[model samples]
Target: MREIIVLSGKGGAGKTSVTAAFAALARDTVLCDLDVDAPDMHILLEPTGTRREPFVSGHLASIRAEACDGCGECAARCRFGAVTRTPDGRYAIVPGHCEGCKTCVVLCPRQAIDFTPRTCGWSAVSDTRFGPLVHARLDPGAENSGRLVALLRGKAKALAKARGLDMILCDGAPGIACPVVSSISGATLAVLVTEPTPSGSHDLTRVAKLCDHFRLPTAVIINKADLNPDEARRIEDFCADTGRPVLGRLPYSPDVVRAMTARLTLPEYGGPLAEAAAELWQAVVTLAAASRPQLQPL
Candidate 1:
């Protein structure tokens, strides 16, 4: 199956908006929101009949107070300062402070610690008007966001295969962090959405380098290209140097905000911005089809 991931080096670059527009235009596709930490595609898609399950990963150490000898060995050995003495002089593991490193669990003289899997978040399979969407939510301050992203992608792939779908459109997280790395690994194409600003130009280079490191074919879309012609030209020059195609240049339009406020995809709203999005999607599909051997899982 062909998988196309939409990403941005920083947030508010219109990444999700573009992804939602692609969802409205693409056919025989499974939609995936890989921004586990902060997913907003559902706001536009308004999914229903979601099948959700707890996402369990990593481990948390809990002290069995009844089995403790009050030696305070675990407390002294924990580097994260997760262990503390209770009011009655008993040692306890602070749930929020614990790093789950298992150092306390291993050093407990009384063998009072119990290490159990942690429920970090939830994953779901839901039905949208366009197709099936596989998305997830990572608990605030939770670790292993990269793992959750991989798990959601696996579910999306399985669902697509079962339904005989040929494409998977993923809305990836911003930045070149672990979650973004997980989102693009083993994908068919990576489409980067960026704006015309100094930070946008800088971050676009960073994310483009990341895709290059993985040998993933990438294309660029300059959102609000008219806002700063010089910076937009700089971004285009960078893309030219890196051999990445500039798919489309979208002008700044308040209609985009109006469409989003109405909770509708650009194509569904129907305007100049929507027309540009449709042309961009066409370029993306053409490039994705011609792109060579997909990046193998890393």
Candidate 2:
């Protein structure tokens, strides 16, 4: 199976929306949202049959109030300074602040601290119109989001393989962050979505470099290309210099916003935006066909 990821340099670059449009247009594909930290792809896909399970990451620290004895000992030992005094004057461990290093747990003179596996968030397998969708939600302040991204990707691949699906369409997290790296690990093709903005141009360059580091085939999609003609030209020039093609461009349109407000895709919105999205999807498919042989799992 071929896995293609839709990524952006930063948030609000229209990565997920473009991904949703692709999902709507692509045939025989499984959907994945690897943006575990801020997953919103399901909003457009409208996933159903969701089965959620806890995603346990590193350990968390808990304090036994009775055993703490208002001890300054645990507080002093905590490197993260997670141990805090409660209103009741007992020592407590802040779940958000604690790094779960277990140093306080190991050194507590009163044996007040407890270390347990952290249920960082929940991962869900769901059904979307495109196919099975693998997605996740991480708790606020949770660490190890890279693992969560990998987990969802693995799940999506497994689902695709089980059903003999041809493609796995993944909506990736914004920026060249840890989760974004994890999202591209096994992708067959990487599509970097950008807008006609200087920041967009800069970020696209950064992400394109990252794709090169992974030796992955990459393409570019310029959204709202007409909004800034000069930046669009710069982006296209950069892509040409880097040997990554600017496969397609979409002009600025308020109908995308209308579709978003109505919880539908561009095609469902039924207009020029949908037609353009179809053309973009064709370009992605053509690129994927040419690059499929290079799509080895990393």
Candidate 3:
């Protein structure tokens, strides 16, 4: 199956907006929102009939009050300050402060600390107006975001296969971090949505290099290209130098905000940006279907 991932070098680059438009336009596809830390696609797609399950990763330590002997050994051995003395002068493991290092669990003399699986977040399969959506929500301050992303992608792939779908469209997280790394691995194509600004240009370069590191084919779509003509040209020059395709440019329009406020995809709202999004989606499909070397994870 062909998998197209929409990403941005930084936040507020309109990546999710473009992805939602593609969702409205594409067919026979499974939609995936890989930005578990801050998922907002449901706001536009309005997913329903969700099937959710807890995401358990790593472990957290809690003091068993019954078995505790008020020994300060666990508190002294914890380097993260997760173990602290409560008001009753008894040592306790602070859930938020615990880093799951198992230091306290291993070092406790009384063996009062209980190490159990942590419910970091949850994953879901839901129905949207367009198609099936496999999304997730990571708890605030939770770790293992990359793992959650991979798990969600696996579910999307499986759902697509079961439904005899041919495509999987993913909305990836911003920045070249662990979650982005997980999102791009084994992707058929990476569509980068960027804006015309100094930070946008710089971050685009960083994320593009990250795609290159994995030997992934990439394309660029400059959002609000008219805002700064010079910076847009600079971005185009960079894309040319790097041998990445510039699919299309979307002009600045107030209707984009209006459509967002109405909780509608650009295409559903209908505007100049919607037309541009349609054209970009076509380019992405063509590129994704083109013959290329098999992608192997590094």
Candidate 4:
């Protein structure tokens, strides 16, 4: 199955809206929202969750107070400074500060420190107005988001395989960080949704470099291209000089926001903006197909 991930170098680049529009148009595809940190695709898809699974990315070690003899070795050995001295002269492990390292468990002279798994987040398989969506919600102030993203991708791939879907359309997170890296790692193609501004140019360069790091084929779609023609031209020129394809340039339209406010995708609006979104979808699908290795006729 082909996995096409929509990403951006920064937030507010209209990645989620475009991904939702593509999901609305694509046939036989599993829609995935890998932005666990701030997943907003559900806002448009209006998914009714059918299956929920706990996503435990890692462990959070804790000290058993009842078993502790107050050796304080674990506290002293913890390099993360996760251990704190309580007012009663006891060393306590902070859940937020714990890095899940087992060093404290081994170094504790009292052998009171035990590692326990913490719930980092949860992923869900939901039935949306469009189709089945694989999405997640990360706990606030949680770490290991990259691992969580990878887990969500795996679940989406599994759902696609089980249903014999042709593709997995993923609404990826913004920026060139770990979560974004995990989201695009094995994607067949990345559709980069960008805007026209100085920050847009800077972030685009960073995100493009990240895509290149994975050697993934990438296409650009400049949202609000008409807002700043000069900046848009610069972005286009950069893509041209770098040999990256610009799939479509969508003009700024208030209709997009209106549709989003109504919790609907652009295509669902069935207007001129919808037509533009449809055209963009076609280009994205064609690019994804072209990038795939063609089978040789026997």
For this target, which candidate reaches the highest TM-score against the unseen true structure?
A: 3
Worst 10 residues of 1 by lDDT: 289-298
What is the per-residue lDDT of model 4 for residues 142-251, given as tens digits with 9 covering 90 to 100? 98889988988888888888888889999988888888999888789988999999998889889888888787888899999999999999999888877788988989
TM-score of each: 0.96, 0.94, 0.97, 0.93
Put down candidate 3 lDDT per residue, 69-176, tens digits, no spaces.
Answer: 888988888889888888887888888999999988888888888999999999999999999999999999999999999999999999999999999999999999
Pairs that collide, model 2: none
| Number of colliding residue pairs in each model | 0, 0, 0, 0
Q: What is the lDDT of residue 8 in candidate 4?
A: 88
Higher-scoring candidate on TM-score, 1 or 3: 3
Cα error, candidate 4, residue 140 (Å): 2.5
Expressed as tens digits, the lDDT of each residue in 1-298 for candidate 1 is 8999999899999999999999999999999999999999999999999999999998999988899878889988888899989987889988888889999888887888999999999999999999999999999999999999999999999999999999999999999999999988889999999999999988998998899888889999999999999999999988877788899899999989999999999999998988899999999999999947343221
What is candidate 3's CA lDDT for residue 200? 94
Predictions in order: lDDT = 0.93, 0.87, 0.92, 0.87
Worst 10 residues of 3 by lDDT: 289-298
Shift of residue 143 alpha carbon in model 1, Å:
1.0
Better model by TM-score: candidate 3 vs candidate 4:
3
lDDT of 4: 0.87
